[model samples]
Structures are given as C-alpha cells and as structure tokens.
Target: MDRITVLLADDNLIVRSGVRALLSRDEGLEVVGEAGDLESLIALAEELAPQVIVTDIRMPPTFNDEGIEGAKIVRKRSPGTGVVVLSQYDDPEYAVGLLTEGASGYAYLLKERIGDGGQLSRAIREVAGGGSMLDPEIVSALVSPAKDSSGLNAEQQRLLLQVGEGKAVKAIAAVTGQTPGAVDRAIGELFLVLARDASVGGKDALRRLRSLHTAILEREEQGETLSRMLPSKLAAKLRADPTASSRTERLTVTVVMSDVRGYSGIAERSDPGALAQQLNAHRQQMNAAVLSEDGTVMQYVGDAVMAVFGAPDPQPDHAERAVRTSLRMHELQRALDAEWQKEGLEPFGMGIGLSTGLVAAALLGSAERVEYTLVGDTVNLSQRLQDLARPAGTTVASESTVTAAGDRWQWEALGDHLVKGRDTPVAAYRLTTDTTRTEPTPSREEATR
Candidate 1:
C-alpha cells in the first residue's frame, strides 16, 4: 500500500519537528514537505500534492488565517488533499467558517493532542477518506445553550441541538416521535429563526444550518445539559460547600487587549453609516477569532476589544491561546483589508497586547451595576502593551505571561523595560515559534535594583 503523504505547516519549528518525528514512527505515514509560513505552505501543497496537510492556524510573516487560507487553497487545487488544522485551542467561529465553506476532507484538532500520534494518524486517515472531523470541545462551545437561545424559541433550540449532534431527520423523528417530515419542517423553522439578516435567502440557509449544528455540538461537549430545577435544599447545600468557595479563589490571569489602529482617523474620514458598517465587519471577524480560541470578550471599548483568559475557567494554556489569537487577529485584519479594498474602502489595521499576572477577577460594582471583570496591575500592563503595538501590529506577553504559558510556545527575549505605575521594570519577550529560547539578557539594573 502507498504510504499516506503529509505536509506539515506550523510557525514553530519544534512543534513541526516533534510532529514529524512522531509520524515517522508510523509506517503508514510520510512527511513529504513542511512550511513555517502560510504562503509557503500553499506553494508546497500545490507542488507536493500531498494526501494530507496538518497546519497550525498562526504562521510567521502574517500569522493569522494562514492555516485556514492554505487549507482552502489546497481544497481548491487538490480536492483530494485532506487538511487537518492544529490549533492551540478550539475556536468555534473558526470551525463554523471552515464548515460553512464545505466541511468534507478536513479536520481541526487541538495542538495539545498532536502528541497522541495514533489519534493524529487516525484523523489524517479519516479526512483523507473524505470525512469531516471537528474538535468535540469546539463543537460544544459553538452550540452552548446561551447561544442557541439567543434568538431561537425553546422548541427550535432543542431541535437545533439534536440536529447538531449528527442526528438524521429520521432519528430526530424517532426520538421526538414525530414524523420525519415534521422533524424536517422543524429544522427548517429552526433555521429560519436563527438565520442572520444577511442570510435571509439564497445560500444563507445552509450557512444557518451549519452554524446551528456547530453550536449544538459545542454545547453538548461542554456538558451543558438542559436546565433542570434542582431541589432548593440540595442547591443550597452545594452552594454552601467551602471547597467550592475555595476553588473560586482568584488567581493570576492573562489579559488581552486589541483595538482598531486608526479608529479616530477612520471615523473622521467616513460617514457614521459607513463607519458603523466597517466597525461591525471588523467586530464580527475579531469576535469569531477570539471566541474560537476560548477567550472571552470582556467588553468593547469603542473600537477596542478587551478579552481575558485563565479566568472564569482556568486553563494552563490560556496565555498561549491569547498570543495565538493576537497573531490570528493581525492576519484576519489583512484578509479583511483585501475584502474592504474590493469595496473601495480604506484598509483597517489593529493593535494587540497581552500580559499575565495575578489579578482580582470577580463580581464587583454596585448591586444594580455589578459585572464580572478583572482588575490589577496586570490588566493595566496588558492595556499598555496594546498601546505599544504599532498600527496593524501586535506585542505579546510581559515576562509574567511567558512564565504562565509554560512550554506551549517559543519565546525570544526582547529585553526588559519599566511599565507605567510599576515600581520596578519588568522583563519582556517576543513570542517566537513553539520552541524555547535562551533567557533574555539580564536587566541593566539587575544588581542595582
């Protein structure tokens, strides 16, 4: 039997090398080519025509959308080529976008699992065989109950969930004991209820279906079961558990800051209607990318988006996701620019920053105005990092963020500097590929300070 040919694309050399080494042990697989950037990966796909391409979502030069864009190109050029995207975390919006374009011959897996060579090989084989694979976690996130209920009626929401779990209309009918036709009609109604305004007619129906399906899967995996009324006594007992309270204790978290590069300039030049349209488009793209990486959009301050990770739910890899999202956002901006140019509008740019440290993140403010948010020097530093980014650019992780990210990504010491309001200067680094780099040069004040 012919060995399955594979092309690997990841900005991190160590990750690519590790994956290649792992696959080398599999007799059925062969790593035919590799790329560290998006453009090269596309070129390699065209040249090698590999049976499979495993790509990282963010790659060098322009880190964002490279993997997805490359996958789309491979599908167009070599319809038989299977594309498996490896991301640091599952992004539902990204998954939705990919599936909407056509889900066959593709897979998206979390990078953490690449070590499971058998699973990776199996996924490759599945996609090469013309099947689709989505991270169960991503599927659950997309279809969370909150999202399904955002615009859907209770019945429509339930139907959407069932359909998203890959249930056939007949199977749905069997479960609900309704006729297949009725189930199908219910699905249609559900689609209509959730369809975006732009999807009123034409190809939008399919998009709506895909979105609903993806969302449902996400919710299911998150263990978000249907709401049930727990006995009041039991609920009170559970809430009174001291361990649960202790578990909620605050910890250091990474904060991500992003903003349009030239919001004021754009507002000055364009009419309110045009500016609103532009801002909406930008927001959608950013929201999709951020949410896909499991980052929460804390709030939108004018044209800026403040997001947080490592809180609400702490994941050891949150800092890595934050950095990766920042890179992807930069890439998305470029793609959006090309889109805007087609409409004769100026290209918009973005700036992003990330920082990690202990911060107080909990419900605060007056009873009526209470909300969940993070507050600390770390948060301020993250905001300052965003301020430091050049238009259409990004800066990542103060020394604290890098420490928290552990070994998930490569780091290069960019040196240390004093941030405003901090008594002492802090060490900083540029997030390199996934491999670790040498310690940054010691601060000039190492002895003095």
Candidate 2:
C-alpha cells in the first residue's frame, strides 16, 4: 500500500519534469524531492532517505561526475537506499562500477528510453526490490573482446552479466537459489580477484572502498566507463621497481580514433541542442558498432571517439579486431545517414583510423584526478589517420596497421607520408572496400571541390 519514495537528481529541468511526469502515472511510485546538482542530491539523499535515488550523469558545478559521486555518497550514508543512474549515453563501465558494490538495488538506463513508461517502471521496481538494471547497449559495450580477458572469475563475470541485464544480486540469488550472504561473499571475493585488497579494515578499508567506488562511478558518470583507471607512469614505475613492495603488469595496445566529418561546420550552423542530439545519435551508433566488434571506447572528444583494443585485457587478435571495427564503423555511419534522411535531417559521415603498437597503458593522474588512458606513438598515429581520412574520402591507416591486418583487408599504399614529430617518413595506406583496384588518385581540385 505504501508508495516507493524516489529522489530525482538531474541538472536538466525538462528531463526531471519528463521523468516525474512518467513516474507520476505509476501508482506505486512517488517523487520525494528533486536536486539539480551533486551536492544537493547527496544532501537530499541523506535527509530524505528515499527508497531510490534516480540521477542523471551530468550535473551542475564541475558537471564532470557529480551523479556518480553522489551515488557513492548515498551508498555510504544510506546503505538501505537504492540508486538508479540515467544517462543519454550507455557507458558500461559506469554500470560495472555502480554494481561493483554487489549489483543490488542499482540501475542504469538510457535517457532516450524514458518515453517507455513500462520499461522505466520496471527498472524502478526492479531496483527498489534490490535488483539491478542496465541498458542493453551498455551490456554490449562491456562484453567486448578487449574486456574478455580482464581476468574476471566466473562469479564476477556472472555478476556483471546479471547487472548488465538490470537484475539485482537478490534476484540473481533467488534464481540461482544462493543465499544473500553467499552472493555478497562472491562479490567481495571478486573484488579481491581484481587485485583490489579487501583485507584492510577501518578507515583504510573505507578509504580504499571509496576510492574504488569513485573510480568506477566517475567513469559511468563522465561517460568514460569502458576504460579502467590505472596508475600513472611514475607511480607504475615506482611500483614495478625491485625496491618497491607493489607489483603490477603493464599492457601494450592498439588505439583507434574516429571523428565526424565537417563537425565544426555542423556545430557552427546548428543550435546547441540539435548539435548535441546529432552527436549523441552518432555516438550511439558508433559505440554499438565498436562494441559489437569487441573494442573499448575510451573517451568522447567533441566529435571524435578514442577507442582501444588489448590494454585492459590483451588479445592476440586486438589489431585485427580494431581494423574490423573501423570497417564496420563506416557501415554504421551509412546506416545512420539513412536514419537521418528519414527524419528529414542532413546526412553526416564519420571517418575512422586505427594504429597498433606498444604503449604504457594504465590509470594516469593523481589520486584525485586519475583517468585510464593509453599513451604512446600508436595513439598519436591513430589520431593522424583520422585526420588523413578527409582528402581520401575513407578511413586511413598507418603502414604498421596495414601490416598487422595482413590480407584480411584491402589496403592501398599511399606511399611514405610525413607525419608530425617523427623523423622517418611513415608509410600510409588508404583503406578501401575493394582490394582489387589500385589506389585512386584525385587532383587537388577534385579533392577540394
């Protein structure tokens, strides 16, 4: 007979209004209060002690990761309360992070799906009943080949899979007929298996847990969830030194970069809201394609995406996977164009490039400012390839990538090209759908006009 109390946190008034309107139609749900930023959300969560706190990823002030941080605060302060995170984007890393505390009473939904009242209500009820929910898109992103070898055990993997589907640990336990204690123990064991120590007690344990929680939550909140924050080069080196007690492994990877064609022109011509919607659509399509091919999207840079293969987890076929993903991304762009045309919008295209090489992959920055990213010539080359894609009218790749790809893809040698910073001229290639044809040569006028 009692209504489910809900605290809504979102910087956007319209989104909050829309969510409130949708939930209002449901008799079992009640909106307790609304907060426009992380601080207010945290304070309200503490004060209201709502059954569930639903929040958006972006909020006021820094707008970087307020929602996720607020979620952490709520989890720490009100263990009895549930948290549901909503975002326009599907970032699996965030879901993983939120569910890391055992995937009970946690949910992540794509904002676009708010219109689906039934789905939204189901998610709310699921989390309220100590269940988890994640957008299908987020699940796909987290299961990529690059993440396949993250060394997660059966229990952790199962937890992730269940959480991805928005099923809570309690629900999972009920299905498996495992006791709640057993499920909780399994999650704790998983944290240990991930090289995170759970032995330390008191303030140290709490601090570590908070740190880990923040790391995972911020990723989801900032749309950077796919990548794991690793220690910085200096810290890693220090940890790896024989004199130091800490030990960690380093990984090599291939980086892929994709940028929208004529993005600046589009942004300049379109309203901010329209441009954002367009970019969001483009990112959704690109993310789906990339995840389907088993690659991790590291970050979104304005109109571009930085993705990686074989760092968080190494695969012998990482280079090949990255190449295949680039090809598929081209197809995705075309598909998106058709969708745009149907909606009476102008079609825009995407350019993607990939490069493979060694890099020190790890979480970089201070404890308060850490981010997981790859650093090396390979990353730089990938960006350069994205830039080179313009005049060629297709994705381009460095010679190293071509060699790595072998005969699987059709590539035409563009000859040794000069790239900034490197003394030696790097051989570049124009990626083509057809391997039989020689590389096409276009005049300056043709390329420009």
TM-score, structure 2 vs. true: 0.49
Model 2, residue 355: displacement in angstroms? 1.0
Q: What are the per-residue Cα lDDT tens digits for candidate 2 across 1-449?
A: 54677899999999899999999999888887999998899888865567789998888888877898889888886564677899876755566556665555677888888666478788787677555566777666654322343566676777655543435455668988998568757756654554442232223333333333343333332222112222222333333462431323355666889988887777677765445556656776677777776677787778788888885667778877887787777777787778778876666777777788888765556645556667778888888777778642377887667666655666666778778777778777777653222443342224324
Model 2: lDDT to the true structure: 0.67
- Give the distance in Å from residue 339's predicted Cα in candidate 1 to where it truly belongs: 0.7
lDDT of 1 by residue, 1-449 (tens): 44677999998999999999988998888887899897899888776567799998877787777788878987886666788988986656677666665565778888787666477888787777665676767656655533434566677768767775666565688889899778777777766665542333424444645664554333232211111211122223334552432233476678888878877888788866455556756765787678778777676677888888776667678886787787777778789789779978877887777898888765445533434557788888887777666536556568777666665555556566776777787676655453233554333234224
lDDT, candidate 1, residue 274? 53
lDDT of 1 at 380: 88
lDDT of each: 0.69, 0.67
Worst 10 residues of 1 by lDDT: 222-231
